[model samples]
Target: MRILCIGDVTSPKGVEHLRQNLWRVRKENGIDFCIVNAENAALITGASVNDAETLLSSGADCLTGGNHTLRNRSVYTYLDDSEYMLRPINFGEGTPGHGYTVLDCNGYKIMVINAMGNINIEPVLDSPYSYIDRVLEREAGKYDFAVLDIHAEATGEKAAIGYAYDGKISVIFGTHTHVPTCDEIILPRGTGYISDIGMCGESGGVLGMNPELVVKAQRSRMPIRFEAASGAPRATGVIFELNESTGKVTSIKRIAF
Candidate 1:
C-alpha cells in the first residue's frame, strides 16, 4: 500500500500549504493513506481548528500528536469525538482519545500507532516501547499493515525504537524535533525507518518559531513568547510502500515540498 506520512504541522501556514498541495500530491503519487502530526499546530497559534479541518480536507486520513497535543483546550472536545485524531499511547489508561487507530482503505486494514518518547519529554504512564509491543501483540495478524509515529526528542531513542520493532512493523517515522534527518531507509526486518520527517511550516525560522524571539530569549536567557515564522511555508514528509503479504516495507522515500 502507498502511504504518505507527514511531519509535524506547526502553524496555520503549514496547514494552508498542505491544503493547497496535498490533494495533488496524493493523486500524483497514488497515495492511499495520509498521516500528519498536529501537536505543534495549536501550540504555535493558540487554537487551530481551521488548521485541523484543513489538513483533513487536504487528504489526511488521520492526525497524530505528541507532548503539545493538550496545549489547546478546544482540541479536548475534538479528541473525545474524532476518530481520525490520536494522541500518544503512553498517556495512561484513562486518556480521552485512542493512541492508535485502525482504518480500512479499500480492502486493506491499516493500523496507525502514535507514541511519545520519555527522554526530555513529559512523564507518561508507561514506556512507549512497551506500550507498542503490547498493542502489536494484541493486534498482530489482524491488520494488513502497521505504521508507527514516534514523537521524540532524542534521535538515539527514536532509532532504537525503530530498530527494536524493525521487522515487526511496516513503517516507523519520527517527529517532535521538526528537523528532518538524513537517514531514510528500510530496516533489515523490512520496516521503513526515518529519524525524523521534519516540520511543515517556516523554513527560514528556527524550528518554525520566529527567529527574533528565539534569539532574544537565548541571548538574554529570559522567557519570551515564541511565534510562528512568516514566509514561504514548506511541507515535509515521507512516502512508504509496504508489502501486503508480509506486512513489511518494500521502499521508502522522503518528501519535501
Candidate 2:
C-alpha cells in the first residue's frame, strides 16, 4: 500500500495547486491514502473551513495542523466535527477537534497523528514526546499502520521524534519548516522519516509568503501585512510504500512539483 503525506499548504494557491494536481499525482504514484498539513491553508497562516474542504474533496484523506491550527476560529466547529482533520495533540486539554484520526483506505485502518514541537512555538502545550507516547500506547494494535506529521521548527526536535518512534510507527514525516530537507531515509526498524517535507505553495516566495512583504518586514523590523505569494505554486511531500502484510515501510520517496 502507498500513502502520500503532503507538507504544509501555505495559502489558497497552494491548496488550489494540490486540488489541480493531486488526482494525477495520486494515480501516477499509486497513492492509496493521503495526508496533508494545512495549518496555513487560508492565507499567510491558519486554516479555513473552505480551504480544508477543498483539500479533502480534491484528494487528501486526512489533514494535520500545527501552531496555526486555531488561527481561524471560524473553523473550530468544522475541526471538531471532521473525522479527517486534526489539531496538535498537545494543545490545551479541552481544545476542540482531535489530535489524531483514524481513516480508511481500501478497507485498511490508518491512524494519522498530528503533533507540534514546543521549542519556539506557542500556546504552551505539553511535550510532544509524552503526548505522542501516550497516544501510541493507547492506539496500539488498533490500526493497520500509523503515520505522524511532526509539525516543528527545529530539525533536531523533529529528528528526535522520528528516532524515538522509529520502529513503533510506519512513518514519521516532518512539517512546519517550509523548506524541504534532503534527509529522507528509512529507520533501521523500517519507519520512513524525513526532517521536513517542505510545503505546497509558491516556490518563489519566502516560506510561501510574498517575498516583498517578508523582506520589508525584515528590513524595517516592524510588523507587515505578509500576503500569500502568487508565483508558481508547487506541492512538496513524500510517498511511502508500505508492506501491507507487515505494516512497515518498504520504501520512502521524496516528491516535489
Output the number of the lDDT-best candidate.
2
The 0-to-1 C-alpha lDDT of every candidate, in the order given, reads 0.86, 0.89
What lDDT score goes with residue 2 in model 2? 94
Those runs of model 2 whose alpha carbons end farther than 4 Å from true positions after fitting are none
Clashing pairs in 1: none
The per-residue C-alpha lDDT of model 2 at residue 96 equals 88
Alpha-carbon RMSD of each model: 1.6, 1.1
| TM-score, candidate number 2 | 0.97
- Give lDDT tens digits, candidate 1, residues 60-176: 999999888877777777777877888898897666678998888869989999999988776544679889989999997788888999999999999999899998878999998
Residue-wise C-alpha lDDT for candidate 2, range 122-162, written one tens digit per residue: 76677888888898889887888899999888899999888
Cand. 2 Cα-lDDT: 0.89
- Per-candidate TM vs. native? 0.95, 0.97
Best-fitting candidate, measured by TM-score?
2
